[model samples]
Target chain A: MEKKKTTIILFSGDYDKAMAAYIIANGAAAYDHEVTIFHTFWGLNALRKDENIEVKKGFMEKMFAKMMPRGADKMGLSKMHFAGMGPKMIKDVMKKHNAVPLPQLIEMAQEQDIKLVACTMTMDLLGLKEVELLDNIEYAGVAAYLADAEDGNVNLFI
Target chain B: MEKKKTTIILFSGDYDKAMAAYIIANGAAAYDHEVTIFHTFWGLNALRKDENIEVKKGFMEKMFAKMMPRGADKMGLSKMHFAGMGPKMIKDVMKKHNAVPLPQLIEMAQEQDIKLVACTMTMDLLGLKEVELLDNIEYAGVAAYLADAEDGNVNLFI
Candidate 1:
């Protein structure tokens, strides 16, 4: 029998939203499913390396890069932001509950061999360069995403 | 052959995100796939009735009801909110492009027989009553969502 396939389109930059996506993906992978997270738009911020990488860029690209979060740890919460207090509070609660952080979750996903693909189109639009993102991730477009999703048992756009 | 299934977890309350969810759901329905949109968390705001419906509620619930958008039209954008300018700008662009608004896309989904489900758990947490939401929609929990999603050809959390 073929393994079940799960494809998720991570489209949000929110810390909580990305956590939810990663949690679900990790759970699905634990169930022995072939999981893929196609990071797009703001979601690609989760794959960033948390440091500025000097690269040539136009004004708009530079603006976008400066405005967007540098990495998953820098992402804000989707709700109750409360002037940047929410993420800190959630982090405290997560630590108390022994829950893994978003960065660790991504590491686990990688260790489990879950495929992580960054959307090349959004990369250009957002001005994110290959060197700025984490290593060992594939880059592709919507056509490749649709190909994975069309045959997927579980396809989610997060 | 069994019909292909598409299930979405509409978890965001943003106007643009909800529009994306409805558009995808409507498209899947048009393709003859059985589709379900499980509205959870802030996503339930889309199903709210435009008019105020007086209902008994605790303090927290009342606060939730008051803070959340009354309906789809009242919801804000996820990005570039610009102190309420974003939604208006997007609506203007949508009008210029002859693009369907989120509310109409929802109506199209219903007409195409796409199942719209409100997550009962979140509804209760948010203090939303049955009379407050649009008519002809189903109310269910995560179990039902999982049942549909486990075999879903396309499952999205938008």
Candidate 2:
């Protein structure tokens, strides 16, 4: 039997959605599938540092970094977000359901040796610096994703 | 050659995320893959009728039905949804990009014979009636989804 491949395009920045992405990725890895998560655009927010990353950037880049969520913990809810309370509410619900937090899920995915890729084009467009992201991750462009996706047994854009 | 299978659990009701789900389903169907979209929980909102459904329900169910989005057209944005203007802004951007609207994408998926399954448990929990949904959709439980997913080449939760 050959090893199956799974490639995910993480495109949403919302906390709940990011949780879903990680849950699926982790599940796939558990099923013995080689999984790759390609983070792009808003999805890059999941990889950001929680604290202000001291990286030298241009004016617009600095502004973008300031405006966007610092990391997975800082992401907002997708909908029904009543004055920033919805995320807290959902987190409570998740805890009740024994679901792990999004940040921990990301760590688990890494521990499971799932390949995490950050989109370089999105980084350029959004002015995100490599120093601002989590360590031990791959960075590449769309072609790189397509190359993997074209042969992959499973491909998803979340 | 064997036909590939893809199953998507459409778990979010937000307009933009629903659009992404439909886009992926439509694309997969175009590629001649057997695709199944299992709409559950909040996802049932995407299948609702724009007008009052007029289904008799318990107090809580009625309240839920009233609170959720009526249909694809009435869905809120997943993020940055400020005073309902975010959806409008995104609609404009979609138009500029020549992206089809959510409702149209749903129609196209139906036309392409993609399997659209409304989760029966979710429907019961949310007080959604079949009469309130679009025509020609399947109703099933988690077993149905798991059956299709067991041999699926790709599985997604959006």
| Candidate 1 Cα misplacement greater than 4 A, ranges | B1-6, B13-147
The interface root mean square deviation of candidate 1 comes to: 4.5
TM-score of each: 0.63, 0.68
> How many clashing residue pairs appear in each of the predictions shown?
4, 1
Docking verdict class for candidate 1: acceptable
Give the C-alpha lDDT of model 1. Answer: 0.87
Candidate 2 has a TM-score of 0.68
Write candidate 2's Cα lDDT for B1-158 as tens digits: 98888899998998988988899899999999999999976788898878886778776566567668899999988788889889999999989999899999999999999999998755764567899998899999755665676568778877
The candidate that achieves the highest DockQ relative to the unseen native structure? 1
Question: What DockQ was computed for model 2?
Answer: 0.19
RMSD of each: 5.9, 6.2
Best by lDDT: 1
